[model samples]
Target: MTSSAGFTASLGRRRAYWQAGVCLAVLLGAVYLARSHWPALESGAGRLAVADQGWLLTGAVAAAGTWAASALAQQGAVVRRLPGARLTATQFAASAANHLLPAGLGAGAVNLRFLMRCGLPPGRAAGALAVKAASGAVVRLALLALLAPVCPGLLRLPRVSPLVVAAVLTAAGLAAVLLATPWWTRCRRALAAVLADIRALHARPARAAALWGGSVAFAALHALVLIAVTRAVGLPLAPLQVALLYLAASSAAALLPTPGGLGSLDAALAFALTAAGTPGAGAASAVLGYRLLTVWLPLLPGLLVLAVLVRRKAL
Candidate 1:
């Protein structure tokens, strides 16, 4: 009895530490945004104030739909049906958690825990995440291919400088060194498990359709959010053109490891908007509007949901 009590206490302490870390990250992220990007944020909010309310409402609806799309994709990753309401709620919470840490770590940990709690083995839960990620990437790529033709010369490949080449080479060498170790063996096994799950999911036609369809809809809805924001702010770009720019900008931003692609995405998106004939200030305002709907506005409620889920042992 004493041992059990001690174990429970230890677990409680770990949870406390994790919660503290999340709080710290949120505080730091807020500070950074205020300190570094206050001007843009303020300007954008002011513009959004006068912007079209109807279009802003459209953007909000699209943003909300993304959670449902994510829930669908997540369910498609596993054979077992996750409770629909909980899954959607988890996606909202995960988005909130996603902004607290860099490179998707916060969201990944949250989803992994939720999956395990839903009765998946650790390996299977991890594989399900992998499947979801892979499908999202593939869907993004396919959409990019289909949309690229609409705006020719809009996305020219940047000249690869020697520095970029050198970085790639260095990364490859490091990856090679890592691959020589026991870690590589574990990674290989993990890859195999993920592949098996992928095969299992694809074997079921409904699951396969959900996986791909949800992924496509998720990306499209996100682009729609940005496009709607641009319209709200009266950016000159047409909706299709804006959508293409968003896909390109987001794809490039994905290469950078930021919390919710905060800095990287903001920069890339602003640049893309400006290059597409928007004034610099207008681009900044549009990006700010997009962030408002997707991140800042939803953040508090998401964190509250996360806390409630933790209390309920949902994650």
Candidate 2:
């Protein structure tokens, strides 16, 4: 029995390693394709270097704000169930991992593991994660719906329309909400279960509101980051125009199965930016820079966190 168990463990480890390799290969291939537009990217970077630094700083702050909002949302979602559960560090680590690891799966797994380690039952932990994710989805869709009317040009794009975008987003949001209705109905129980596991925090209405507000702000900040990238690359486009373009590009990329949305994101962003009146080269540069800051720059820290988590037997 011992030998069989050891063999099973070794097989599992081998499978995990193989899966990681496959993910890495896919990520690398996508990245290589994204880099194929390097000449244009270089030109765009040159233009961005001459743009106002103040706006860029604001963009950076907005990104950080998004991170904070995400953490707050996680905290709020789990508060009722895990009253003392503090997920700030776990949130950061998970976000970092999501950005670093291919396909965003790592972050979700890490979050689940984090909750389990914190002593929440599997069902409740899963429910909390579901709620947090649902909240984020609703917030993003809500913002998109609100902004759709203001950006009719986005609707005119090939294979898309404002009404269609709105409908799709609304449907997704509704589906998520409906799927979570059971959990929401049991909110009191869920909250109590979560609260029983931790003792350092308390659930509050204000915190929940803040979490939602932060999520909205994060979505806006993400839009602003794209705008900053465009300006930095010296793209000739209004901030609002850039923001809309960024939103569309990002939305499309998120739907794709590619790791980190690599090729899809770059291509979509560059195309959308150019359509929005920026030069193709300049748009490509801005998109590249945006990826650099939001994706590549955070990879090292994410890997470090993953390593630590592994060493501690938490991952």
Candidate 3:
């Protein structure tokens, strides 16, 4: 009887190992294929070679500042003071993870875990994230509206084709189905909690100020980084125009539910720069340089920080 039981256990272990190997192989294959097929990944490196190093360095510094800005906004969303160092590390990790998981789930999950660890109830923690996101979105739009007038022709969007409209409607329909079916009850509860939290947060003047101010600074800094990259790539567009184009492009990219807005954001940014009077090569170089600073360069370090934070039980 003991021998028979041992044999069964060994077989089960083998099967599990085989399954894990198969899954890993599939994932790697998909990634490899994607890199080969995607023009952004293919051409970005080529453009980076010719990009001006000094402007790129400046953009990198600006990119690094974004995590700090995000941390500030997050801290301001709640009344409890979070540990500054840990909070910044968490934001960096979240940004790295955002590229791995789809539809912003990576960052959301990280922040949710961090907030719960900070002693908030699950609902309240989720509410805090909601408040932060809503505040950021509102501030971004406000900035766009404010800057559009100053940028003059930067706000002009190209004519949308019929295919684009259909694609949008299809995406909306899918989202509606998912909301209506799978998690409606939980979503309703979460929304209610978030609304309550938002009201309470707004009632606190200091927290409100921090939240709104940090959000505005975050958006502005991101635009500034892109503007720096554009200049580095020899794109001659005005600073205000670059900032406005960055805002508009980023807002459009947010609609696509990809991880970290990867391919969609790259394409949108390149198109926006080109439409704003930059040469195609220059626009491509600018987008690549900006992403190199913000995403590719920091990714490894961010992951290392994430692992350390996890080991230390900070998140």
State which candidate has the highest TM-score: 1
lDDT for every model?
A: 0.87, 0.68, 0.82
Per-model TM against the reference: 0.86, 0.70, 0.80
Which 10 consecutive positions of candidate 2 have the poorest summed lDDT? 194-203
Q: If ranked by TM-score, best first, what sequence of candidates would result? A: 1, 3, 2
| Decreasing lDDT order of the candidates | 1, 3, 2
Off by over 4 Å in 1: 1-43
Please write out the lDDT profile of model 2 over residues 39-150, one tens digit for every residue. 7767766766676777667667666566666666666666544322235555556766775454566667788887788777787677667666666677867766777787
Off by more than 4 A, model 2: 1-36, 49-51, 81-86, 160-204, 309-315
| Candidate 3 residue lDDT tens string, 70-130 | 9989988887888889899999999999988656778999999999999988878878898
After the best TM-score superposition of candidate 3, give how far the Cα of residue 85 lies from its true spot, in angstroms: 1.0
What is the TM-score (0 to 1) of candidate 2?
0.70
Backbone clashes, candidate 2: 9
Residue pairs clashing, model 3 = none
lDDT of 1 at 152: 82
- By the lDDT metric, which is better: model 1 or model 3? 1
